[model samples]
Target: MRKKYLFIGLFIFAILFTFGCTSGNNPKDSFQKYVDAWEKQDYKTMYTFLSPSSKKSISEKDFIAKYTNIYNGIEVNKISVAPDYPKSFKKDSDGNTSIPFKVTMSTVAGNIKFNDTAYFSNNTKDSSNPWSLNWNIKMIYPDLNTDDKIRIDKTFGKRGEIKDANGSYLAQNSYIESVGIVPEKLGADAENSKKQIADILKIDKGVIDKALSASYVLPDMFIQIDNLSMDDTDRLSSLAKIPGVMLKKTPARVYPLKEKAALLTGYVQPISADELKKLSSQGYSKDDSIGKSGLEKIYEKQLKATDGAEIYITDKEGKKLKTIVKKTEQNGKDINLTIDSNIQSALYDQYKVDSGTAVAMNPKTGAVLALVSAPGYDPNDFVLGMSKDKWNSLQNDPNKPLLNRFQATFAPGSSFKPITAAIGLKTGKLDPNADKNISGLKWQKDSSWGNYYVTRDAAYNSPANLLNALVYSDNIYFAKTALDIGKDNFINETKKFGIGKTLPFEYGLDASKISPDNSIKDDIGLADSGYGQGQVLMNPVQLVSIYTSFVNNGNIIAPYLNAAKGTPGKILESNVFSQDISNTILNDLTQVVSNPAGTGYGAYMPNLPLAGKTGTAEIKKSQTDTTGTENGWFIATNTNNPKLLVLEMYENVKNKGGSHYVVPNVKSIFEQFCK
Candidate 1:
């Protein structure tokens, strides 16, 4: 009996010892070894721990390159690991091992400190039931300890939707399917067929060849192909079956009415090498495309979206064995706009091929009705990696095709009369009923015209109310008005109306439009200011704003870019002033079109009480060619609802163009839309 008891005990001890030995060699131990290997830069050992599929899909060279790039970006602070990893198991549910992780990172965000908030989690399904893990590997935001993530987590977070006032889609996101080629499978003769493919795709032959030849790229990848136009897509995909191509699925940025608001919506240009360096400084990778310009740049944070990823193990034969790790990608915010896309389309058509800009606004609320910038390019041109030729064409075009001229600064010509009139009225220089005579001024230094042109004009011209000055667009009348208002007072008043200043609206540049010249021609320049000419500069919206102040009875509301309240980086900084214009000035303007003898009577809205000013500017010439010389402008507001403010102008037009030509178009637009 004693011998049997001893044998049983020995047998039990042996079984316990065997169990301990097997557990010691389990996946958990292998995962720990992998972590240590990574810390020591034993890349070869780490490579051994990677799943077989990962090894095949990505080589050690690729892995090293990715690691190096991430390390360089994260060297600012190397995160330290905890003494014990929290509830961590090195193995996944299927007894498959995981990549090792053991620490948390923290940062200051606004008022809160987020600790490992950018968590990388994987819920990998395995063949084995009741599978659980210790700690999973994470590629947290800018963490030095982990690799840079490869996925943009769409399921994790999403951006808001962008739409127009009538619920028209200005910009939106949709799932897309794409294609790629296996470079290694490409035959040597494949290079010879490049021209044939290029011809088929209607793209430059050199571009196709270059894309095919780049290393670390799919041989014939459709990295970015247009998701629209099924006719061409069907044709192209059939041609790509030439030897070594494969199909891929992905999501792409699609702007449906891409041509309608090309400049206003902006384009997405690819990053140059310099841009990559800049982005790296900001903790972003080359793969990312943030906003470049237009509403895109102005609201990048809200529009930026990311896709998430998961890392997993694969068997020796190349089957996915386990999900080593995972993290989801986040999407950018949605944007909504105040733009009436239909009106925008209508305005674009009005330009036809003319190089001009048109902008309409709601005088009561300052909502933009339509915005058009001519010599435009399709925003789609930049979407799928802009070619050098197309990009250069846009960049070198003298017309400035990319500029949103609705917010561009140009000499207002006579169109600025109303703004000057407002300045005159607000500064108490001239009453609406006070007629100021135009008199000639002597030059401080005598030139071709001698001391003076002796241009005799009237002050208190009984017929010369503010409306009369605007009607005749009398240059000398406004000249006296400007001098009466004085330079300092005039500048201040213009600035208040958002002239000579960056508008709170996003469509303008940093520099204000005030021209700098300090001479008597400049005084005559002030004369021109009365009629929207001389040193005075303003954009389309400024006309809208100034006219609003006039027609809205001295109330000035700042312009609105988007009607949606939650655009990512866009915040409306509009201003509204409560000042009042006299009943007298409003009456004179109202009668400008109603009165038959008035210059602007031809511009009357048939059924509505309307007031407007016309400006014809002699574009200062440095050349003998009078072709495309000056600008023609007209501005108007509907008195009944004051709901619409329209400004239209044409440049370098035929028939020695002036404000008359544009008045018809403005009247047409106002007549058609205001109702």
Candidate 2:
């Protein structure tokens, strides 16, 4: 019995030993473990699967370095390994085993798919040898060989063009010479060469030195100077002869409208280091040009193109061996605006001497036809690299050319009388036909309010109703009407018109303020607001929107630059006025331009019936003290079409007349386009 028990024990021990050997020598298990480590980027665990001979040839640090270097050039979004790719192990006659794998890597450049084999071996002659992988770089990329590496080549996509409503180019890419200096070629005369280049380019010599001093710039690399106009062939030829100077034609953003549309179209500049880091996930490089302001900045993503990429294997000397992947770059989408270039040019031409803004829109649809801000600068100056002196001149100019006057706020003056009239009619505080019988060229405010007095032009002393009051721009009549409506009703009516609220526009707008806190506390304040005087500030765009309600059956549609036939404009305030009130207001505005006694009579066009209001707002030192400086305004609409509304404002008019100064220009614009 003892002998039988010993035999059974020995047999059980042998079976257990056989099972342990089979598990240790399993090549499939070793390859799978190595693949799992690789997928997780656990290089330390991956190194554990390396064969003793392989580890002897390369250290763990070198193994990790090989993969990390390839990863730095590409953004890996995802890595997918096929579960059934390595179906079963295949044994070679030489006792080597291999497992096939299919890996798909999703990257910013696109997807990359490749098939590779992981080799494993077990030395049958050595009793203690376990299954081990003979890993190499080829296992990661099949095309990789000794002294060969994977390289990614990027091709930037074409930027889109900005076109006007008539399909005219506003901003587009044009070929310009990229001037630079090859530092290594400068030799011992680098300083002299830089001075000569700067003199020819009209740039500071320090700019060249700064470029050369960059840590990343190598001696052979070209340090950029500035983009020169293609028409500057004479300068290019002369500069090319100088040592270290080089010129290459490259596509650059160009503003065809230049000074005419500079404030509206804006410009682009090279991305900064901070922008590069923020936009890295979007594939933007430091060399890319991005919109800095205006519409260009607003539609950046739509105007920005997708870059293409080429992946290939390259030798140690950087010669391509084979192309693995190629992708075509997609151009950006073109942006169509509602601006009419011809009308825009006309508007700019008319306001050449004035420092102000003007906007014309389709009252029914709220499509802005033209927007002009005077004292404008050439956007091309920025695109072609503006000089510091020129930039400083623009910045220091008293007129403020860079300021977007369209979005700026100003006192609406008598142009706001219509809104006051509408509020009086809407609140049932004043009758359009009832005789207010207020008689004054100038009327003093009540002693309780202040010693201040409301004054009108000497020609407007007649008894007034709403129509004659608007026609004569009688400040006394309107102020009394506002007082009758009371302060609360006036505040509510103005708020209903979207005052004190920001307009939803792509270019951004300042909220029209009635007061600092949008409230009027005193009778004098109410009286001033009635004449569009007391702390009432409005923007041209928002003012146009308010005027649009009169022609649109009392629905105030927010004005938009990109409104089209199918895209409806946003309705900021609905039913702001009854149709009867709108018609009454329209009729009153018409008489203001048609009647010889009206203040807007200067804007009369014999061929066309025009409806508008004239305003002469005095700039005040305080709410009580009026300055001699005045701002002239004319807000007009065509009665024949009823679809157009134009607002013009000229600042600091001094003694150049009242709203009468801008009336002829408005008439000229109306006759030219409104007809």
The most accurate candidate by lDDT is 2
Candidate 1, 1-675: lDDT as tens digits = 999999999999999897765534334455556556555555566665555445565677866676555444323122333223334435445555433344432111001111331111222343221222232233323222233242211133444456778887776654344434455555677675555555555677677556666675754444432233322467557656665555454444556676668777775544566776555444334456656777777776677655344443343454564443354566677777888887788777777767788888887777887887886887655655566777899899987787677766777776676667767776778787765544333111126434433121223344655767665656666767877887677766766766555666655553345565322344544544555555666767766665666655466666777776423222222232224553555566666667775556777866887777766666755223355477777777788867877787788654644667777777777777878
Q: What is the C-alpha lDDT profile of model 2 across 1-675, one tens digit per residue?
A: 999999999999999897755556557666667778777767788888788888888898988877767755665545666534344455688677776778887555777899877677885554544678887768768888868988988888988878888899888888789998888899688788889888988878988888889999998888888888787789999898998888888888888777788888888888787887688668675457888987788888988877888888999999999987777788887888888888788888887768888898888777888888897998777778888898899999998999999978999999999999999999999898888777656786666655578887764455578888998888988999999999999999999999999987777888898998999988888989998998999988999999988887788987777633324556779999899999999999999999999888988888788899999888968645555589999999998777678888999876888789889988888888876
Overlapping backbone residue pairs in candidate 2 total 0
TM-score of each: 0.68, 0.77
Cα deviation in Å at residue 428, candidate 2?
A: 2.0
Query: Ten residues in a row with the worst lDDT in model 1?
Result: 105-114
Q: What TM-score does model 1 achieve against the real structure? A: 0.68
* Residue-level lDDT for 180 in candidate 2: 86
Model 2 score (lDDT)? 0.83
Candidate with the greatest TM-score versus the true structure: 2
Give the C-alpha miss distance for residue 478 in model 1, angstroms: 1.0
Q: In model 2, what is the error at residue 624, expressed in angstroms?
A: 5.0
